[model samples]
Target: MKGVMASVQDVGAPREKLQALEKIEQDIAAALSSAASALQELSKDKPAQKHVDSHSTAFIKTLQEVENGLSQQISYLSQVTTSQPHEGSSYGSQKDMHMAMHRSAHVKSRLSELEKLKMEHLMQKHTGILRSYSASNDSQQPLTPHTPQQPHTPQPHQQPQQQQQQQKQTREQQAQL
Candidate 1:
């Protein structure tokens, strides 16, 4: 009788240990899943950062190019405007003078347009950079706990008395705790 009792106790102890191990595994899995979800949420910001960086670099390069073009255009316009038409020279025909004047005016208009465009581009780029900085700062904030709050739903067949009883029981349990 004593040997048979000992064998049963040994079997029950192993079963209880196995149950505890299973519960621990379940808890670990839940923690890992939550961590993975948080990582995925944070990863979404990387592409946006890359996009902003690329645009900033491109904008600076393009603006430099526009400035260079504007300078060249200004020099060309000055050269056209300052040249004296030779007196009694065939190259200084009335038509040639008219054409030179028209070219100078066109160049000046283009230079004005380029300046305006550069200003607009600078404003837009500055705005974008500021927005990106704000967004980056926001993204750096720590993630909040992701536990989903579920709304309580009563069963269709449950009576009002049953609901009241359930609520009472819950309150009593909480009071005990």
Candidate 2:
């Protein structure tokens, strides 16, 4: 009779263990269901996220276009200033010309700085986009901005004072004639 009771107890132990495991499985299923529903809810707003991304991309593109236009204009102006013929024999006029040349140089430097800033902004924006895209794609690819090789535009050098004076004298003699 004691052996029969021991056998019964052993069977009950296994039954209890099975019940506990079944309960654990049910709980896990319930949690998964809850998570799935939450994901579905969040997915409903994905269109809004996409719309914002598109708008941001468009804005960046427009800004880039504007920067490019300004850069071209600056390049053209720098070229025109450099190509201008020298003038004036008077010390005062020479001083004014010197100041103008300095100012032109300053402008070129400022424009170059602006271009650098614009490029940096563009790179940052692209990096952000790449990060977000890679996150969505589950990719491990690194983001790198494509920096194009820009031909160095030679800066305008100041003309010699003697050459400026000679041009000025020639202009004066022609005017007198």
Candidate 3:
């Protein structure tokens, strides 16, 4: 009779352990389902993130480069203005030559102003983007990174010696010309 009672007690102990394990498994399943639903919500917004990233590239850089190109063109025009052609081109009157010179100067000045404004615009945009990314870094968002680092790093500051050397070279080239 005592043996039978001991056997029944052992069976009940195993049954209780099984029930506890089953409850744990159910709880884990519920947690996983909740996590999965949140992931689905995040996935819905991915396309919009893609759009912003597409626009976010050195986009301002390309714009700045264009402005630089325009500035170079403006500089060329200035050079042309400063250096008069040795040979004369036919002109009807002193007034006509004056008008043509005035027109060229006006165009050069306008372009310089436009290029300056464009450079400012590009700079403002670049700074704004930098601030936004710095803020994003502070936000501590999930690791779903939208941007990948490029192989080439962009540096804003030029070395003083390099700049001086470049200036020297430019002066030499101009002197030679």
Candidate 4:
């Protein structure tokens, strides 16, 4: 009876841990979604600097949360896998080990995705800052007085009669010479 009770408790323990990991994964996914939405909003045409700064800060905070959640998931998965049944040490069933490995792989993929998103966010933020700086500079510059442009000289095609008379005179002079 004692051995059976211990076996049941051991099985229940890994299940509870896996449930906790799933909860964390869900939270991380939500954070990533929020970050993505913020990026989209920031990409809209001509947002103010104040809005950009606030969005960027929010994005950074969400990213940090996702990273922290991934770290915790990784550490927890490591513990589960390392303590798995091996030659008589009954820590968890093979199913638990497989699940932990699968979860670890998923977390790693999410981390890579998070890295790509971070790079995109940084680039967006940099471009926004540059645009605002250039816009501010343009607004501060004094406008120079407009001046009328000089009229263009008429082409030969546009003054055909004058050109023809000049050509006729030149021919007459050349014939006399």
Candidate 5:
């Protein structure tokens, strides 16, 4: 009989959440750029109805705040996420190893997200930087940004499969260590 091991396989990704976040991020990012432009438009020190576009004064303020906060987080979150060291396993029961794999999967998923966000942040940073640095002659462009399927339902049996794979990989890594 083949004993179950802690599985350590890539469990795809949370597509819906990722898609939603990416969409929201794009929307917010666009809003931010538009708000910046509107700000530049408004702060022109000119008085005109055209200058006073539909963008709310309050909305602009909020976008600026969010942009700043997200910008800061992008730099920091990316760095910390990449630098995070994976903890060594405590080395115990089959159950423990199994649990560890699930936890590691969760961490991996989060790290992947953080890394992606970090990249997006960097892109945004450069976009803002270049545009600001060369507002005089920058060309017009719109920045835009994956597919994963969800299981029909959770598989309790798959848990053992994942765990067994996890155990095998863990043991191999540990042996090398």
Candidate 6:
């Protein structure tokens, strides 16, 4: 009876240790499950983040292309407005000359329109910059109006004509003297 009692006690001790080990294993499995769920959630968000990033990049690229096109148009208008008229070009008749003059007037008007658009674009860009700067600085100062300066371009033909007139006037004065 004494030996049987000792054997029973030894068996009970091993059963308790086995139960503890099974509990520890269950806790480890629960922790691993929680970590796996968290990783899955993060992975799901990654695709959304990538989608947003791609959209923003595309938007920026499109905006840059539009800005480049506007700049090119502005340059073309400036060139047309500053170009010298070909006065020596042979026109078959007065009607042809009149048509040429009309075309020139049309181009000038279009150039003026483009210039206004350029000015507006510049104003908007500056306003945005100023707004951002003021916001960052926490300043509430009134924004001053910015005036775009018009470049003075002298006509190529006018200078020589003016010099000739001046020489002619000098000759007349010398003769009078």
Of the candidates shown, which would achieve the greatest TM-score relative to the real structure? 4
Off by over 4 Å in 1: 1-92, 139-177
Deviation in Å, model 1, residue 168 alpha carbon? 56
C-alpha lDDT of all candidate models, in order: 0.51, 0.50, 0.48, 0.57, 0.50, 0.51
Q: Write the per-residue lDDT of candidate 6 for residues 97-160, one digit (tens) a residue.
A: 8999999999999999999999999668766655654466433434333333432333566677
Clash tally, candidates in order: 0, 0, 0, 0, 13, 0
* Model 5 alpha-carbon miss at residue 173, Å: 42
Give a tens-digit lDDT track for model 5, residues 48-112: 54645655554576566556544444543443456532123222345577999999999999999
Q: CA RMSD for every model?
A: 49.9, 41.3, 45.0, 33.7, 37.7, 38.8
lDDT of 4 at 156: 55
lDDT of 3: 0.48
Q: Once superposed on the true structure, which residue ranges of model 2 sit more than 4 Å away at CA? A: 1-89, 139-177
Looking at model 4, how many pairs of residues clash?
A: 0
Runs off by more than 4 Å, candidate 6 = 1-91, 139-177
| Local error of candidate 6 at residue 133 (angstroms) | 0.8
The per-residue C-alpha lDDT of model 6 at residue 90 equals: 36
Q: Where does candidate 3 clash, by residue pair?
A: none
Estimate candidate 5's alpha-carbon lDDT, on a 0 to 1 scale: 0.50
**Which candidate, 1 or 5, has the higher lDDT?**
1
Cα lDDT for residue 112, candidate 4: 100
Consecutive 10-residue window with the lowest summed lDDT within model 2: 145-154
